[model samples]
Structures are given as C-alpha cells and as structure tokens.
Target: MMGHAELKALAAAALLSLGALAPAGAECSRDIAVPVALIGVSITNNNGTVGGIYPEALRAASAKAGCNLVFSVVPRARLEVLFEIGKADILVPASRTAARDQLGIFVPMIGHRATLISVQGNRAPITSAQELLDKHELRVAVVRGYDYGEQYQALIKELAKQGRLFQEVDTVAIARLMQSGAIDVTIMGPTTFSGAVMREPRVAGLMDKLRVEPIPELPWSYSGAYVSRRSLKPEDQAAVLEVIEKVAKSSVVMEGFQRYHRADILAESVRPR
Candidate 1:
C-alpha cells in the first residue's frame, strides 16, 4: 500500500487530471476576464490600466496564445467568488490549495515562502505563530483574502478572535500601515512585502526600520495561475495553459519581477518549489 504522502500525491494527481478530462463548452469564448489587485508586483495600476509582473507575464502569454484576455480590478474575496462561479476565466497569483484543486487546473508560476515582518523595535525570528500571539501589544495586519495554508489559517483565526487583527484589502494598504506604525507586524513573502512598500513614493525607507524573519509554522507557498474549468473553449484553454506554463519562467515574469525585487529573491521567487 502507498504511504500517506504517496496517497496524498495520488489523490492530487487524480483531482488535477479532472481539468483535462472535463468536457469543454462548444461556444468559442475568447474574451477571458482575469482579476487583478494592488498587491506588490503581482498587480497594480499602471498608466490607468492594470499592470505588474503578473499582468505583464500573463498579457504576453495570452498574446502568444491568441487569447483575448482582459484584466479587471477585483478584490481577493470577490475574485475567488467570480472564479468559482465561472465568471472569471483565470486566477493568476493565487495560492494553490487542495480545495482550490476542484475549481481548475493550477499551473505553478512562482515559489515564495511566507515571512514575518515587523518594525525594528520588536523581537526578531518568531519561532511560531504562537510566539507572535503572546506579544499582546503587537498588532497584526493581514491581507483579507490570502490563504497561506493551514498554519496561517490558525494564526489569523486567533488574531481575529483577539481583535488584534487589522484586515486590509491589499498588500499595498498593509505596507502603508506598516510604515505608519499602525500595524506592528504582517506576514507575507519578502518580494510581496517589499514590493508593496517600495511602490509608494517615500516609503522605500520603511525597509530600514523593518525586521524580517522566517515563521517556522509558515512554509513555502506557490503562487500560480488557475484556468477555470468552465471559462474557455477547449482548444483556447489548453493553449492558454501551455503558453502561461512556459512564459511563467521566461523573461516576461523574470524581468517584470526584477522591477520590484532584488536579483537573489527574484531567482528564489521563480525557483521550482
């Protein structure tokens, strides 16, 4: 018999295969809507339009695949809802989970780990979520819709219950809160947290006052694209998924990420998890 890890892998493979075997709609739907948010380098407003590393890479992929892709600004919560209901075609920069596996075919795009970030005055290297929980004076800010797996869920649940959690709509807002000293800590990837802070005109210096450390309970997280099962025509969906899988490691994503992160972290961001 297969071990527990192997059994989980087999179950996951079975779930993902459903995307390929699912029946495609007969209508040729080329107009695909992708949701966007102002979070780090993933999505932001550029020249009055949605632009960022994610959009940059995705736009290039869609163009190459002959897919008519449209980017619409949507909050994280509503974004999930739209995709689940078949109103959204793609979910880029979404953290993958087993529950989400039933929704679409997830193609991993980048590898990043959740980190603990706080001001310089506080403690460094929080051993676990429980450690941070003990610091009653430290207020935590969390992006409302992000799912960083089970450990994160438990941490934020306690934070919410204690009324010490300040939920924000996006990472940009969380970064601002960090700078203003309204939030003592926030947990996220280094690329995302730094990118969000640097996007502001004068908050780049916020990094100087920040203390970043690994959270033992929070492990590696992969951000990727999920092609909705009910969105595109069969041929178009396959083409889009193939093109994205390739370009996700190409210059489209790499150079776009370089615009917001250091060379080392960018390498780690795109590293195979």
Candidate 2:
C-alpha cells in the first residue's frame, strides 16, 4: 500500500497534469489585444481608460471571458490592416456588414439611433427626409465609413454624388465645420454628439446651437464586437463570442446603456434571438 505522503504527492502531480491539459481559452493567461478604429468619439478612444458604454461593456466581457484586453485606438482605416497582419485580435463596436462578416465573427451588443442634427437657427423647415432632400442647396456632413442604414446610406450616396455631402474622419471635425458655417446639417447619434461636445471644450458650446431630428423611417443601427478569425484561433473566437453574449445580458452592460439613456435599446439587444 502507498504511504500517506506518497499518495498526497501523487494527487498533486495529477492536478498539475490536469491544469497542463486545460484548453488555451480556459484561463486569463493570454492577453487579447483589441485594435479599435473609432477614435475621438465617446464610445472608443486612446485614453487607455474605460469611460464609454461600449468600451466598458467590452472590458466587462473580457473579464468574463477569462482573458485580458489590450485596447489600442488606431485610425479607422488602419483597423483592418492591423487585424489582417495579426497585430489586433478584435474590433469593438463594429457594425455588421457582409464584408466584415467575411473577416470575422460579430457579437451584437447595442443599437444606436442616428439622428439628423442642424444649426438651431436654420430657417429650413427640415423635419423629415423629404424636406432635407428638397433643400438641395444645403451641405451635409457625415463621418466616413459609417452605415446609418440602407435608406440613409442611399441618401448619403446621392448627396455625395451631387457634391452636397462632406465626409470627415470624426464627429468633432464635423461639429466644428457646422459651427463655422461650413456645413448646414449633419447626422450623429445622441451619445456620440454628447461625447464629442464633452471631450472638446472649444466645441462644447456648439451643442447649444444644434438641434436633433429623428429619422423615423430608418431602423436603429446595431453595433457589436468583431473577433478577427485571422488573429484568433477557432476555439478562442468561440470563447470570445460566448463571453460577449454572456456579458451582453449582464446588468453591467445594461447599466452602461442606462448611463447613455439608451436602456430601451439595450433591452432589445439582449433579448432572446
């Protein structure tokens, strides 16, 4: 028969062996670096601190996934390059599209209501899409690479073709152009507009001069985390999706939406699908 000490030693060895055999995604030993392209806005930034709802929710989800997240803010155009080169493992708050779907898997998180914003004193009675369309003389500003839905996208394309649309890299730039009378109208989500105003003291007063109008015919745009298959292994991608799905239903994520006055959308995002 084995002695007590010998049995204890054998048990310890077995436990160690089990740990060694554990899957790579079973623990937080590895750090997943997420390269975020959306910068200078509220949702994602290079500040290296969690502030916005999307970043906070992503951080929470990473914790639940048994992995650490390294969020780096890169320019919008550079995001896909980094992922393709295996430098970034994920992209947060990415909108679902056929092109992006070919590169990775997306875990939907929240929805955003894209609203039309204009100068407060503009005399144009632009309450609907048709009214805005009738005013062909007005210059409209929009962020490049943003999808405001199919109908809005078609309108934006038509405006761009007619040279009435201005595409900028960030919202603050668009707001500044509007303040300087360079553009007559722009589209921005509530959280995004608030974040832009809050971050830039120079443009903070621009909020007072702006008014928001809803695009009633368009559906809200849903944003999610895109896990790059090129950067992450299949099992790791599965783990990330699981974590994102679980966190999307958590109270922490719901609180984030609540902070931005978007709790109703959060409820819809996490509902059974």
Residue-level lDDT of model 2, residues 57-137, one tens digit each, is 767667755777877776655776776677777776666666677777877666655777777873756667777777888
Model 2, poorest ten-residue lDDT window? 264-273
Q: For residues 223-261, write the lDDT of model 1, one tens digit per residue.
A: 788888887777767777776777766656655676667
Q: Candidate 1: where is the Cα deviation over 4 Å?
A: 1-29, 122-124, 249-251, 263-273
Candidate 1 pairs with clashing backbones: none
Q: After superposition, how far is residue 250 of candidate 1 from its true place, in Å?
A: 3.2
**How many clashes in each candidate?**
0, 0
lDDT of each: 0.76, 0.68
Off by over 4 Å in 2: 1-25, 28-30, 38-41, 44-51, 80-87, 122-130, 260-273
**Model 1 residue 207 lDDT score:** 62
